[model samples]
Target chain A: MRIGELAERAGTTTRALRYYESRGLLPARRAVNGYRTYDEDDLRLLQQIRTLRDFGFELEETRPFVDCLRAGHPAGDSCPASLDVYRRKLAELDALIGQLDAVRTQVGAQLARAELEAGAALPGGPEPRCELTHNGPTD
Target chain B: MRIGELAERAGTTTRALRYYESRGLLPARRAVNGYRTYDEDDLRLLQQIRTLRDFGFELEETRPFVDCLRAGHPAGDSCPASLDVYRRKLAELDALIGQLDAVRTQVGAQLARAELEAGAALPGGPEPRCELTHNGPTD
Candidate 1:
């Protein structure tokens, strides 16, 4: 199918697909009319790439997994590299969580001030304190 | 004080201070020797800016806050624009949280799959009936 079809099927924008190709994350064989053609493997790879990206793996970091998937899985061999990637990303995620927590505290303060001035309770009635905001994951 | 001392006091780097200035977040009354000096108010403002940035406000978004702050409480009474900025950013934060939540689900799924493979678990786990390999937020 066409780029638009591929994008819609993949649940991503066309621009993002173009970007993925440009970043060498997804390679395409150009058609005679200069349009990109994607096969079944390409579709699967795109899904995998998007999955990793949604997990907050940077584009560069997801390359290894893409390479692994593309290379044909050897029976029962551990993707140690993929595991290492996750471990490192987990550390980064922890740091990101800290940053988010800081944002949350500051935003809470801002929200409180807004609520005070508005003379009403916030509509959300206390949001979850995630990695980007709020110190209390428990809260 | 020197840029180093100012940055240390501000809990940021000299490079960041320079970047902030370049980005118009900070204004420097440059010294004859090409150094930067920040008075008490500037120091206080720096802290506020950092706090706001930590809260996910972009540098430009803080302009009205700085204006209101500089103009004092009476100024605060006059400017509704800052409130607008705050509201818009709150909306942005909500969107960001949604994006991150999607990412979190992706990570969680990846973690589960890796665990299942490593532990030699059966191909099918007891069903919560999970499958969102590329689907939108399972949440």
Candidate 2:
């Protein structure tokens, strides 16, 4: 199949396919007519790359999975290298979630403090009062 | 002080200060020597911008805080506009954290399933036992 057909069948752009080729993630063959040719295997590799990308895997991180598929594994994650990438991604996500949660807590605290201060500084806000003359109602 | 001095005191780059000026967030005054000048008030605004930025606020989001400080509020968050920005940021963070958590769960599940399949597909993986010869132990 031609590059355009492969891109259409894979639900990706020819530009993206070219970029993958540039990165050597999905190399295409040169046809006799000097056009870029791809096979169903290349489409499978592109699909794997796209799926991992949807899972937040960086383009480079998808390399191991692509390599696994190219090496004739039944699935991308069938290789130890691909499994290592998955483990690393899990760790990276955990660390990012932890950091973002901390930031959320800090921002929440700051917002609360600022709101209180703004309220207290408002015009006609609560003021300390003397109760010497109103002692009968002190209770 | 000149732009350099303000940048140094604010712990920011002159390029950043210039960019802020270009964005009209921290416009500096021109001196008789044709140099851009800033004051302590500008420094306070810059500090507010930097603090919110460290808290993951976008450069544009810091505008309200800077405006609040320029309006002579005790702090950036003393104004309704800045508080609005805070509220919006909190909501944004909440939504983002929720999405990231969902993604994390999905990636973790994928990893777990892939690992199990890979283990099962190992060359020497578990095989069905032959119990026909052990009829006496079938109970």
Top candidate by TM-score: 2
Estimate, for each residue in B1-139, the C-alpha lDDT of model 2 and write its tens digit: 9988889887779999999889989998999989998888889898888877777788899998888877887777778888888888889878877877877777777677777777676777763322111011100
The list of candidate 2 runs beyond 4 A from truth reads: A126-139, B126-139
- For model 1 chain B, give the 10-residue run with minimal summed lDDT: B71-80
DockQ of 1: 0.16
Candidate 2, A27: how far from true, in Å?
1.0
| CAPRI-style docking class of model 2 based on DockQ | acceptable
Q: Which ten residues in a row have the lowest lDDT in candidate 2 chain A?
A: A130-139
**Which candidate tops DockQ?**
2
**What DockQ, on C-alphas, does every prediction get?**
0.16, 0.27
Alpha carbon lDDT at A35, candidate 2: 96
Q: What is the interface RMSD of each candidate, in Å?
A: 6.6, 20.1
Q: Model 2 RMSD to the real structure?
A: 12.3
